[model samples]
Target: MFCYKFPCGEFQTLTKMTETGITFDPPVYEQRYCAAIQILEDSRWSNQIKKVVEFGCAEMRFFQLMRRIEKIENIVLVDIDEPLLRKNSTSVDPLVSDYIRRREGPLSVQILQGSVADSSEELRDTDAVIALELIEHVYDDVLSKIPSNIFGFMQPKLVVFSTPNSDYNVIFTRFNPLLPNGFRHDDHKFEWTREEFKSWCLGIVEKYPNYMFSLMGVGNPPKDLESVGHVSQIALFVRKDFLEMQLENPLVTTPNLDDESTPYKLIHSVDYPFYVDTRTEKEKLWTEVQIELQRFKKMANLSENELDSYQETYKVPIGLILDRLHHVGATKEALLELLQENNLKIDDECVIIEDCDEESEGSDLYELSERLSQDVILTDQEHEEECWDLNQES
Candidate 1:
């Protein structure tokens, strides 16, 4: 076994060797990283993300990026290949070490050799779970079990999943004419079309209603082929129950470190089990929204006699905005700024309300509802139909 320590006290250990030493490379799929980062940056719960477990942390390319994010405090890297895990655990990558030193608090790094099909108790209570470019490698039987284990058993607040878009293989074949008919890599069991991927995710939601998902593409599809697919498709799943509970009590306990019977073996110990809390920046904005809603009745133009009559009427639009604030991954600050901007514009207008017609009121409410749907929920109906075109061609 080999062990290495970084300047920041982060320790890594390698317990296995391959016939040929593993080599680390920078990630070739830059778009996937960009998508993942955008999800994290846009999240209202960004400050709540601290512990992340990566299912297939090959070469630690994406892992390096996760470590650099200011909120992440603990990371568990898992891979099916023991030798590859060993190589990455002991790697002297400058980017990895630099991220460790720059972290604001103690950072724990755990490396494990395992398959996603197998459940690990250590993974429970994590904030965010990630599996990038990994689902394609698993057979369908095994792939079907992953969501249940990750969402139902581990129950992380957020899950970032990505898989290759088989519809985009033609673009790849242009560079490698001799590429196999249906596979990109020798080990890839299947590359799913966008529809198949959506079906699989929808099934997960059906089984686990506590979770909700949004899908996006990583790379740019050709203008003509835009309907077909992008290079990769990603799904971000959020657990609604956890989101509500986290806002009330942000501190969560780490897994029991004393339980040495865990499948994961630690090479270096940074710290044992302890409690950590999400950053309060976003939560503060949520509180501000709550407080501001109470004051809305006072700000709107209403006479002493009219205040009671219009109070509930004025709440309809504000309620729509508040509902959006609850569901959107956008930061509280951004949502608050948007509300303030729209309020300023409304203040500039001179309006005299003679009567509140129920029909007109409903129409106005529907407009706010439509805007919320467009902004908070992400769906590409065109891409879904285009991705299905590959099935017809086959």
Candidate 2:
């Protein structure tokens, strides 16, 4: 009945329809955070986002996704709860901060003990501010201060806010009986319906005439159940004055922020693995290969143990490893060169240990993996720059 062209330049026709209808479970609350990241990534000013502030950073689980935005140089996390912030920021138990800090990039993270309702001189003029699942937990008096403190005073180029929708409480009650009277969390003072949420966002737009706003839902119900709206709602606001200023002067690359000020007490920080543009491209990549190859070596060792279920010939899949390396801007030639240098081999199906001996009963594979785990030495060690020139350690 319908024909469609596919990406491979092939056309397909749909001839029959299934009688069974599709079903959807209730929306997951994590969709709220995903919507925030998508909004930033797809924004018209994506290139303009060099700094972002995550106000009301609960447990900081969403911080991982924020690190992937290529342009973000600094991320500021603020939460009022001192005890909770200390635990999350500490490198000890429930290691949220430590986990997010494993990456290596030009990016740096700063954690502060502060309330969103209160304004500070250091927290002024950011590219974007994300307050997710935060406002509902504060009292009305504190909640009122957000608009003046955040939008009026700080005045970021973009702002995103999300909260639980009370209309979707019925769906939640089935899974969680102790929702504290249909609210998402026990600490929340109040959750708003879709109408109330939209009205509040509109109020911000009207109060601050220099900004524009849009509203959308996350976690829609099944096809015909349109009456039940999303379990969570998102309100995104953009600064109109700033964008107009940008249009008039396109070459102004600097954001309206105080990058040199140090009012915020620094907490956990990380540098993610990103390539640099330098003259020694090959040497730098070779050093990085020597560093990150340990991950695949351990993976191969673990695969040997599960060989009974997988193919005994060799267990690790090559495509998955390639895909991961591709993320760090590694080429296929780089991967092949690294593996060959480390005495590793791959056949048509799986990555094979060079000395994988059936007679040794997998002991050879384990030992080779252990040996490769040692520090990888670069071929051109005396070539002016040492291995540490990449500024990375295994």
Top candidate (TM-score): 2
Backbone atom clashes (below 3 Å) for every candidate: 0, 7
Best by lDDT: 2
Question: Tens-digit lDDT track for model 2 on 1-394?
Answer: 0111112231121112134422233224445655677767754677788789998885666675676566787788888876777777742122232243333346767778777876665575578999988899899988987897777667788888888888876654555564645466878899898889978988887777767777776666544556767666778887775445332223223234334322455555544444455647666565555334445555555667555443334334556656766656877777677667756666774556332343586454455444454323222332223223212212
For model 1, the stretches where C-alpha displacement exceeds 4 angstroms are 1-28, 92-102, 242-262, 265-394
**CA-lDDT, candidates in order:** 0.60, 0.62
Give stretches of model 2 more than 4 Å off.
1-27, 90-105, 173-182, 241-276, 280-394
> What are the per-residue Cα lDDT tens digits for candidate 1 across 288-310?
45334333433454455664455
Per-candidate TM equals: 0.55, 0.57
- Clashing pairs for model 2 are 103-271, 103-272, 104-271, 104-272, 104-273, 105-271, 105-272
